[model samples]
Target: MSAATIGGQNGAMPELITIDDVRSAAELLRGTAVRTPLLPCLAGDPDRPLWIKPESLQPTGAFKIRGATNALLRLTKQERERGVVTHSSGNHAQALAYAAKVTGVPAVVVVPYGTPQTKIDAARRHGAEIVQCELAVRQETAEAISRERGLPMVPPYDHPHVIAGQGTAGLEIAEDLPEVELVLVPVSGGGLLSGVATAIKALCPAAKVVGVEPELAADAQASYRSGVLDRWSAEQRGRTIADGLRSYLSELTLAHLRARVDDIVTVTEDEITSAVGWLAHNARLVAEPSGAVPLAAYLNRADELPRGRTVVVVSGGNMDAELFAKLV
Candidate 1:
């Protein structure tokens, strides 16, 4: 497909991210984030073998490190001195905190109340000042903190740098499996999905890029099907077990999804739990519910997916110990 076909010719379309942007991000992330391995899934059918990109192996046990590190590194010296702020349910909060600690910058994080204790502890361990609020007001609270402290806001997603950094994962996938026919990515605010889809589409145009989401929190899938940026209420999305996948997609990410994504699928809650258990047992990979959504979609909706070599991105592993034990 041509760029014009995916990215509309109208001037309203936002500046689309290119392969070059992903390359630059890869360069920036070379020494900062781990190059997660692409391991073959021994449990998957031999007829349609599956590969897993376990981003959980990162220092923060999540893919958020890639974007967080890149964004923090790009800050000017003056901006760094002033510090950075962001709002996240968990993973990005820890990522930013860890990045700030390593870069010698103060960091403030606004997190939703009732977030997994493990994630909150991880952020605290990195020395981030934490402010708690309802998920609905988390963004406003973070913005207020940023303005009050004169700190730049490192948004969890939406920014070009974050998307570019996340795209590096796609670049690795493409490089490792040049013949990969299908790529499954779990969607939340769509940064990872947007970046990965953009990179995969550019590097392997013929490969199918599918975004997976929990059926209870399927706002991204709804937006893709409607061609309108559909959003779900915080209460509605909070019904899912996948704590990290509750956020709605931003306009920037919605634009990329509309252009580059082949399809969006929703997996049931049961399937997500099953996937988490399956990965632990068969792949010996610890996956949070949000991270297991792609594998869930693959296992439950195989009839709808393309048959061939497939890759699923296990986005994070930051579940509470109690929850992990109960689920697995």
Candidate 2:
């Protein structure tokens, strides 16, 4: 189930990140990132007992820290001296800023104009120079900045190091719960899902790894089903309340998903908000809209999922104050 041999359309596949790559990333993230516990969900039935991997508990309040930190740590001293640049919707921006601060690597993040104030402010607080751009031109803006400033571009998800870093969480899950049957992960650019599915499939061969996303921004789901890399426009993706999940998958991530992931599912806007409130009330966890999508799938689409000890990856908790108040 590893992505090592996932064939490509050109009959020549680039080397996919492997379990050993994930393990190496885990070693790099050992002290910097939290080994988040898999807490038993109080809301579970006998047929499908539930557990939550609250990556929201990470230092930057999201699992993006794992990938961000790993990428930063792997950089050469000369590269670090030159600094790094990236573009992100929210969580990864904060994660990269926070990681850069700790490592004394100067960082600049090109964020879209419509990103939440909370996330933008958090990134600034971590000392990243924030550059605002239109949502559609974020990556291009970042690339221009990287070239002009002679800095490395640490992409949010497309890079192998980033995927391997995110895989650390899956490694933890397989180690902690050997008998786990289903793992529900939130999908945006597919960094978390790609790495997690790779690790989960390698460690717990029988366990199923499913990717959950908002129906409004379900390009990955569409791509998975069609066997082609489908993309939703910025206008289409921006309709989702899950700000952290508006980004589309990279070709690398799509390849990883096609090879390792069992299924892809989408939940409604109403279901997303409801799951946000449900986690706060039932589990006392503060899950952002993207983070809550996995729980939304469990609550609303259980009939379509595998039964047994299920693990839901709560990807982040960077909720806006007003939105959190309104939802919970």
Candidate 3:
């Protein structure tokens, strides 16, 4: 059943995304973004083995390119002329910068001060002007810049275009693993999780969609459980080593999570670190802590999850060299 069918039972549907939107985004991203590979985990259960979708292979070293490219492609000529601005902790910043550079549109990114240097450098490399701000004020600062410069804001998440673009990852997963039974997606702002869940549910309705988050930054899990939007203080979320999973979800993403996600799970700092190491050593993939959360869930909470062939979305790999060395 489609989200539209489910939304009708609840009330007037909010502007949620659809499968068609995802297909359109896929068309736009055909030559721009990488259609990352899904590799098998040698150590997983033979009968119900795990596969990893390494989105870190994208040019910006993350899956953010898909949504960023789609959002930019949809911009009107007038809007493109005005340029674009948005806030991100890391991956999305680089994604938008790369997308803007390729499309020949100027871009400005407001990023949290403590974001890894590697991500910041990647954004600058793509010709995007960088604006630094405290975690609490990143969005406000981006909005201020947008208003002052008459730049249209392409939000990191919460927009239909962004969500639809991210959903293309799910479309690929379903197409690659038609008989797959479960998917574990790392959740931060919920764009990736929301988009992946929507596409997976629409294409493979029986497949379970699960979200993974760091226990310290578990706002998405809290919001999913309470049936209300919940947020964590920046300081609280910053306590986790998974810097990319700090943001809270918007109402639009929360709505998608509610409608499509089957379960939300939390992993500890140790699990994240171990998963990062495992990805590098066993899977030959360099995964940032945020991207490792889904694998952490698979390893530490397998008993809690449904029995099936599982696919873990390794969302990004943009950690500092020293940090990567220390973790892996």
User: What TM-scores do the predictions have?
Assistant: 0.93, 0.94, 0.93
After superposition, candidate 1 runs with Cα above 4 Å error: 1-11, 116-118
Who wins the lDDT comparison? 2
Q: Mind giving the per-residue lDDT tens digits that candidate 1 earns over 1-328?
A: 0121222335366776888988988987877699998999989878779999999998898899888887887788888888989998678888899988987889998988988776788888999988999977998998898778887888878787888889999999999999999999999999999999989999999999999999999999999988778899878998999988998887778899999999999999999999999999988999999999999988889898998999999999988789899988
Listing every candidate in turn, what is its Cα RMSD in Å to the true structure after a full C-alpha superposition? 4.0, 3.1, 3.7
User: Where does candidate 2 stray beyond 4 Å?
Assistant: 1-11, 114-117
lDDT of each: 0.88, 0.90, 0.89
> Which tens-of-lDDT digit does each residue in 229-301 have in candidate 3?
7899978998999988998987788889989999999999999999999999889999999999999999999
Clash pairs (backbone) in predicted model 3 = none
Q: Can you write out model 2's per-residue Cα lDDT over 156-254, one digit (the tens) per residue?
A: 888888999999999999999999999999999999999999899999999999999999999999999887788998799989999889888877888
lDDT of 3 at 116: 74
Q: For model 3, what is the alpha-carbon lDDT of residue 240?
A: 98
